[model samples]
Target chain A: MSPVLEVRGLTAGYGSLTVLRDVGLTVGEGEIVVVLGANGAGKTTTLRALSGLIPAQGSVVLSGTELLGRKADARARLGLGHAPEGRGTFTDLTVDENLRMGGLRLPRNELPAALDQAYGLFPQLTPLRDRAAGRLSGGEQQMLTVARALMARPRLLLLDEPSMGLAPQITANLFAELRRVNAESGTAMLLVEQNAAAALTIAHHGHVLESGHIVLSGTGSQLAGNPSVRRAYLGV
Target chain B: MALFLQRLIDGIGNGMLYGAVALALVLIYRATGMVNFAQGEMAMFCTFITWKLADHEFGLGLPIVAGIAGGVIFGFLFGAALERVVIRPFESADHLRQMIVTLGLFLAINALAAWIFTADTQRLASPFPSGALRLGGVSVSYHQLGVIAVLLVMALALRELFGRTRLGLAIRGASMNPESSRLLGVDVSRMLMIGWGLSAAIGALAGALVAPAVFVSPGMMQTLLLYGFAAAVLGGFDSAPGALVGGVMVGVVQAMVSGYVPAVGTQLQLATAFALILMVLLVRPQGLFGRVSVERV
Candidate 1:
């Protein structure tokens, strides 16, 4: 498949601190692309930059749509869903209301079907739908965060950290569902993760980052089996 | 016994008005995290507009009812303009600076009102019809009943607007998380402006309604705003329901204290709110309805 998104020489940071520089990548349509890095390595910045949270100098084109200068909401209106690092769930809002904010760009009539689909992916979210998102368990909140993003019916799903603090079993389940999301919806994803072994396990393409620039780029399995990666990152 | 009942009723009436203004303060805090010290003054400013519109000569000569309708629209527009022109630039300023800024805005508006309206304490006839309904032992005047009715209606409309409607939901969501809400297609700046505008309009209702009973003047709302601020804190800064309940309770307390406790005269009314603040802060800093939010690693 041709690339659904193309990023070249992406450079972003907050105020004065530069977190990402000279970073480049491409995401094929319906592909699961992962960015694996240690803490504070500009992984979250990449996602934020793409979704218009941080101003950046680079080309962030989703099917040729320029996303760099747009406001966060305007970018969202163009179908980019970002589940920020630590899930940023509205603490006071109910799970139902939290999800409602995701698809704020869609017509009102489409909300029910989108909600039903979201609830299907994470059945546990259904019972706590009425409860405030803040009261949810860590794992449950993570799921809610992801589900909330899906409400936008995004063409590109940018996940900051999907496996953070999740149980191994739940993490596995989440990865499986993510794969399914890409497969079923034809949605492209740029997932950032600190869990190198786990992220490389699911992504079709993988890029390893250290101090901002992409140091290694290859197929997921190739990166996973690399001896250098195993010795340094995979903790083999 | 009749005198006691009468004081109690009057206290409750005043409390609701205080609550109305307090609710405005709370609304501003929730959306922008700043208190509009001039909340009462803004109400006074808008009420003057109502007074002008009701004028027979240079004015539109509209009926009192028409004057009120005009006041509501003008209040909204003026509020939105103040927010956009004044409050918007101060968004990045620290809380203390913001507080001082709003205080300045309040003083400026008050000065303008005094200059235009001539600082005279103008008598404003009751917008609502004047009458009292007797139910067995107690009598309820239309003025008090009218205030209560208006407060209730305003509360319900606010609840529905913020909780259920799209515009309201967007505003609610936007304030709670500006970054995420913006990405979700909400214009955070515009949303904040709308909130200030709505809060201003609500304040106009209270000021205009009370103009007749209290008399309209630039400094008329100084004391009332304090009561409202105290009520908002007592209720929880972010909880609208708390502001309402706390307002009514505070009003009733003031009335009862004036009646039962001879020491708590007009001078001591302000003291009552300060006392409430001390007691509430000692007990529940989150106020009545606010929940403490815990952050996780």
Candidate 2:
């Protein structure tokens, strides 16, 4: 099957400082691709470039459409959703408003159903719907970012470090929810993560990003068992 | 007692107008993190447009309501156009430059209005029926009550816009976090432009409403702008409800100080508003209704 997202020779960075260099990857329909990297390994930059939050070079095509030259909002409308690094939740807004903004392009009639699905997956959000998102726990905020990205009902969702500052148990729970979302909705995901063990648990395929280059690629089970991955990331 | 009550009502009526302009200040600040120093001048220009529509110059001699409506529509377009032409160019520049640009706008608009309106103080007719309603001991002018009513409706409409509608959500979202709003398919630039347009329209309404009492002229808003700034700072820079409450308090304080304090009566009434602003800045920088943003690393 054709990949939902295809990137070739992707390079992006802040002005005068290149972070990603000639990186290439793909995620098939309903697949979860986890990118494992250490701090400053260009993981967040990759996601930012894909989301058009910053400038980038090379090719990023989503479901056969070239996304280069499109602005961030236009890319979002074209069905590419990114739950950015640091959660990026509208902290002052109520949980309900945050979720509504997530599916901003959805038809008015479809909003209720989309909201219901989000609330159902993260039942913890139901009670806090009226509360501001900033008041939520870190884990809940992570869930909110993920659920918000789902609001767009994108063909491919890009997540930057969903496990940042989250407890192990919470991280496990988040990955489980992500798996369920993929299974049910057939949505593809490109997950950027530092937590190797938890990320690989739900990922079907994995790539290791080392200094803006993809150093290794394999199935999730293979990478989880790899000696290099275990030494550098898994800490096994 | 009747005299005291009358002053109090008058203060509130004027306060609401100040609050209207202050609301525009707050909206622009929240959206762009920059204050439009030219806001008062923009309102002054729109008020002139309002006056022209009502005057026989155009020979239409439309009524006050239609004139105000024309002012509002013109204000909206003019505001949007200004953002695109003047502010959008320096969008990425430093905040100091942005302030300078607005200052330039202030002088240009003020001068333009003087040249066009010819420095004349025109009598802008009041849409409200003249006379007063006597209730028990206190009497209130219909014009004063009308100003209060208009401000109340504006506050409610603004509340509804921010709280209920999708467009409002987009604006609020853009103001709070432009980057996130963009990620969510909201055109942040477009939202900012709309914010300017809406704010200018509100300012026009305030100017038109107060013109009859103050007289419509190029420099009429100069003194009122100080009061409006004081009201905005007193209420907090980011809160709408705070703007209204702050405006009323500033108005009441001025009235009370001028009336009760012998020295401040007429000559130093403006001083009272200025003093209140200084005290608020020194003591509680966040203002009454503004949140003290705590950043968690």
Candidate 3:
């Protein structure tokens, strides 16, 4: 499969402190690539840097366009959907409004279809469309976040810790939905997660990030079965 | 009873003017999370622009209505330019810094208007005909009725804009969560600029509406600004509707206090208005219609 996203020599930090150094990765067309890391491992930072949420020194090419130095909104309009950490829902806005915001760049004629597609993917959100996003439960908010990201119909979706604070069963269902989205829509995804076992279950390939560096890389099963990865991440 | 009714009607007319200014304040506050100390001065400047456009002897000899329209358009461009040029640099700055910048603008814009317009109070022709309609021993002047009618229409139009339009949704989303909004392709910066522009446009209209009452001068909006701030606080800083209601309440209380209270009359009107606001705030810290924000850690 051809690469849809490519990054090389990404170095980013918060004012005076460098967190990600020489980090590099790629997502192939319709591929699910997971980056596994622990707390403070710069997993979130990497995704933010890629999405132009922060200043970074790197070469990030989405499809064929260079994304470095562009504003976050500009990058988003170029078909990069980022479901940020903590499910950055506009708490005051209704769920339907939030979905509309996600499709802000879509052609006006395509919006209804996009909304329909989003509601179909997360059927539970349909009933709560008019309710405020902050009023939704954790599982529902996560579903909304993922569903909102998909509203853009992006070529590449950057997901940060989709299982964070979610129940195991909910996480499983979410991963299953993500897998289905990948299979059906052919949208590539680059997911960062601490939940190694669950992320690996659907990821086509994976990388282990340690202190901002990619320390190991392999196919999903290869990393899942690796004794070191299992002990360190899976707590097995 | 007739006297009381007349005072109430007069109070509502003044209150609508206050509400117009307060609405402008609320718009900027919602968009940028900062209370612009310069809001009144900005309106004052736009009022001078209106005067210049309408004044036959000194400037453009356009019809008063056309001049007011020109002022509103100028206000929009001036406000948008200020946001893009002056305020955008301070977008990421802390609240204190932003407040200081607005305070500086308050002084600067006020001085700029004084220099440009010569600080002389100028007469602005009222759009309404000078007449009063009497009903049941109480009379309401056409100017008062016009102010009330115009404000109601403005408020309803604003409500429609915010409640129904895509631009309004983007602005709301941009203000509430800018970072998340950017990820949604909302162009948060542009939304913020538009917010400032819209607020200034409303302020321009407010200035034009009130110019006939207070006359056009640099210091004209000073008292109005204080009352507008009071109205915004009374209504709930986050609510557009609250600002209007708060303005009317403040106006009624001021009128009633000055008219009825023998010892403390018109001179003590501002104090009485604040006293009421303080009481209401003490009871409900969020103001009449503001939602108490609950942040999740």
Candidate 4:
């Protein structure tokens, strides 16, 4: 089977600063791939390039469909959900409205059902549905972002820093929830996490990135066991 | 006291007209996040279109109502086309540049109106009844009440449309996050066009309504635009209710202030709106309804 997403030599960045340089990675269908990196290592840039949020050079293909030059929204309509850094929820909008926006890729008739599924995935969002997204706690907002993306029924979820700044308990819960989502829906997720040990625990494949390039790639277990990976990222 | 009620009615009549214009400003701001400084000029220009259709000089043989309907249609199409051709190209540009473009439009449209209409104020007839209704000691013209009623309906319709409809959801969604909206297959550019279209159409109606009161002149709405902008800012640039309240409050206070304060003559009336805007901005930078956004670093 073809990989759900293929990134080959993808290089992109902000103006005058190249954050992602010739990065290569792939997430096979129904697999959770983790891109583990320290801060400013271009992990976020990799996702931004893949989702067409920034100018990118090189190939980013989804099931052989070229997505290198398409718009961020166009890529989204094609089932690439970007849970950007800071969760990128519409702060002024109600939780329900935020999720509905996520389902903009879905048909109007199907939106209610999809929203229901999002609420089902993250039951904490049910009560906050009528409240502004800004009112939610960070962990709640993060869950809302993930749930909102899932409303589109995206084939690949590009989640950036899902565990960032959350309490350790909340981080553990988020990882468990993400694992459940992948297992139940067979969703292909490319998670960028700072917490490498927790990330490798759930990720099927792990790629360690440094300065915009993938410095190491192997099964999660292999990277977790690698002394260098343990020292630099996992802190084992 | 009786004269006060009558003055209040007159103030409300003017306020509702200003409110419609302010609502237009709010609508465009909600969609584009930039105030259309030329909103009044655009409305006035369309009012001239109405005048051209109704005038015996360049008579299209259409009645006043038909001319108004035509003006609305033209306003919608004109706004959409202008946005597509002029504004869309500069969407990612700075706010100052955006404001300047609208200001440029203000001058262009004003000059165009002057060239066409000869800078003379023309009397336009009101479609509403001319008879006055006496409540206690105050006399209220049917036209004044008509303006208020129409303004209320337009406000309600807009509120409902933006808050309840699927298209509205998309518009709010797109305005909040254009990138994400596109991901969901919403045509953000098209929505921006629709936003401008809707705003200018309302503005046209306001122009037509107030034309009867103020006498249609090429520069008629310049003072009115100041009030509208003030109302928009005071009410929060994005809140419809804020616009309405601010418009009416400014109108009534201006009338009352000019009337009560002997030194504050009609000449000083225009300054009050600007002064109020400064106070509001200084006191609460976000305006009354604008929720201050907190950025998570």
Candidate 5:
């Protein structure tokens, strides 16, 4: 499969404190690639850097277009969608409004179809379309965030810790939906997660990040079976 | 009873003017999360522009409505340019720094207006027919009725803009959570600039509407600004509708107090308005219509 996203020598930090260093990864067409790490291990940092949320020194090429030094909104207009850590919901906006925001760059005629597609993926959101996103339950907000990100019909979706505060069953359900989305839409994803087992279940390939570096990378099953990844992330 | 009704009508007219300024303040507050101290001065400058355009002898000698339209357009450009050139650098700065910058603008713009306009109080022609409509025992001036009508229309148009448009959604989203908005493809900076532009344009209109009554001068908006702040605080700093309602309430209270209360009279009317605002705020800090914000840790 051709690569949808490619990164090389990615390094980023907040102020003087470096969080991600020399990190490199790629997501192939319709591929789900997971980066698993512990707390403060640069998992979120890597995604933030890629999404242009922070300044980074790297070559991040999305479909041959260099994304480095671009602002977050510009990258988004170029078909990069990010559901940032902590859900990144516009808490004051209604569910439908949030979805519309995701499709801001989409043609006006295409928005309704995109909205319907999102609602179909996360049917629970349909009934709560007028409800404020902040009032939704944790699981529902996560669903809305993911659904909102998908409204852009992005070529590459970057998800940071989608399972952070969700219940295990909800996490499982979300991962399943994510996997279904990948299979059906042919959209590529680069996911960062601490929920190793659930992430690996949907991810085609995985990388283990340790202290800002990609220490190990392999197929999903290989990373799932790796002793250190299982012991460090899966708590097994 | 007739006197009471008359005062009430007069109060509402003045209140609408205050509401217009308060609405401008609320727009900037919602967009930038800061009360623009320079709001009134910016409007004052725009009013001067309108005066220059509409004045028959000393200026452009355009029709009153045309001059106001020119002022509104100028206000939009001026406000957007101010955001891009003066405010953008401090986009990430704390509230204190931003406040200082606006306060600096307040002084600078005031001085600039005084220098350019020669600090003279100029007369702006009223677009309304100078007559009173007699209804029952009370009479309402056409100017007063005109001010109320104009402000209400402007307010409703703003409400429609914010509630129905795609640009409105982006502005609302950008203000509520800029970082998330950027990820969603919102040009947050552009939205903020538009916010400033909208506020200043509204302020220009407010200035023109009130100019006939108060006359155009460097310090004309100073008292109005105080009243506008009271209105905004009363309405809820974050709510657009609240500002209008708050302005009307403040205006009514001021009029009633000055009319009926022996001690308050005309001199203490401003003080009485604040006293009421203080009481309301003490009870509901979020103002009349604002929602209490709660953050999740």
Candidate 6:
């Protein structure tokens, strides 16, 4: 089957400072692809480029449509949902309102169902619905941010560092929830993370991005067992 | 006691006018994160527009209500267009430069109004009935009551807009974080324009309402602007509801100080507003109803 996402020769950078050079990758239908990288491996830049948050030179095909030259919002309408790093929650807004904002581009009729799905997925959020998002704990905020991205009902979800600053237990729960989401909803995910062992357990395919280049690629178990990956990322 | 009540009502009546201008400030501040220094002048311009439209020969000669409606619609379009044309270009610039641009706008708009309407003050007919409601020998004009009623209604309408509507969510979302809002498929620029447009419409209404009392002219809003700024600062520059409370407080304090405080005297009435503003800033800094912004890791 054709991949849900396809990037060819992706090159992105800030002004006068190139970070990602000629990177390429893909995520097939309903698959979880983890892009493992260190602190400055251009992992975040890759997601930003694909989501059209920053200017980049590449051919980004979502499903079948060419995604280049489109604005970030337009790309979102075309079924790309991004839950950015550091829990990109609207702190001032209530949890319910944050979810509403997440489903902002969905058709009016689809919003209710999407909201129901989000609430059902994160039952802890149901009780805290009216509370301002800023007051929520780190785990709850992360859940809120992820749930919010899911509200878009995207064909592919781009998650940047979902485990950063999360406790080990919270990160495990988050990954488990992500696994359930992938298995049940068939939403393809391009998860960029430094948490290799946790990411590998859920990821169907894994690629190690080093200095903006894909240096390793294999099945999840293969990357997880590799000595270099185990030393560099898994820290085992 | 009757004299005090009269003074209180009189203070509230004028407070409502200040509140209207303060609402305009809060609206623009919420959307764009910068105060439009030209907001008062924008209102002054709209008041002139209302005056011309209500003129017997030079304009449509519509009734006062119709003229004000025309002015509001015109103001909406004018403010929205200005956001797109004049403000949007420098929106990405630093706040200081943007503020300077608005100050330039203040000067330019004042000049434009002076050139078009001349420097003469024109009397605007009040749509409210010319009468007073007498209770315990305290006479309250219908016009004063009408101003307070209109301001309350505007506040209620604004509350509904921000609380229950999808468009309101979009506006709030954009104001909070344009980057995330864009990812959610919101057109941040368009929302900002709407904010400016709505603010202008409200400012126009304020201009028409105040015009009947002070008379419309190029400089009519000069003093009113100071009061409006004081109200916004006192209420918390970012809070709509704060603007209402701040406005009434400024008005009452000014009125009472001028009336009863022998040391302050009527001549130092403006000073009273300044003093209140200073006190609030020193004590709360966030204003009465403003939430102190919390940054997260």
Order by DockQ, highest first? 5, 3, 6, 2, 1, 4
Tens digits of per-residue lDDT for model 6, B31-62:
77789999999999998899889978666788
CA lDDT scores, all candidates in order: 0.85, 0.89, 0.90, 0.86, 0.90, 0.90
**lDDT of candidate 2 vs native?**
0.89
Error of 6 at A125 (Å): 2.9
Q: Measured by TM-score, how close is model 1 to the native structure? A: 0.95
Model 5: colliding residue pairs: none
Cα lDDT tens digits, model 5, A1-236, are 55999999999999999998888888999999999888999988888888888999979999989999899999999989898877588887899999999888889999889999999988889999998888888778888888999998899999988997888988888899899989998989999998898999999999999999999999999998999888888898
**TM-score per model over all chains:** 0.95, 0.95, 0.97, 0.93, 0.97, 0.96
Worst 10 residues of 4 chain A by lDDT: A83-92
Here, model 3's chain A TM-score works out at 0.97
lDDT of 6 at B123: 88
lDDT of 1 by residue, B1-297 (tens): 777777778888888898898888888877776778878888889888888888675466679888877787788888899989987788767779878888899889999998887698876667677889886677888988998889988877777776787787778788788888876778889988998888888888888878888888898888889889778888888878788888988898888876678798777878998898888899999889766765343
Docking class of 6: medium
True contacts kept of each: 0.55, 0.55, 0.65, 0.38, 0.65, 0.51
TM-score of chain A of each: 0.96, 0.97, 0.97, 0.96, 0.96, 0.96
lDDT by residue (A47-86, candidate 6, tens digit) is: 9999888999979999999998999988988999999887
- Candidate 2 stretches greater than 4 Å from native: B57-59, B93-96
> In model 6, where do residues sit more than 4 Å from their true spots?
A108-112
Sort every candidate by TM-score, greatest first. 5, 3, 6, 2, 1, 4
lDDT of 6: 0.90
Q: List, residue by residue over B189-277, the lDDT tens digit for candidate 5.
A: 99999999999999999999999999999998989998998899899988888899999998999999999989989888779767867
Judge the docking of candidate 2 as incorrect, acceptable, medium or high: medium
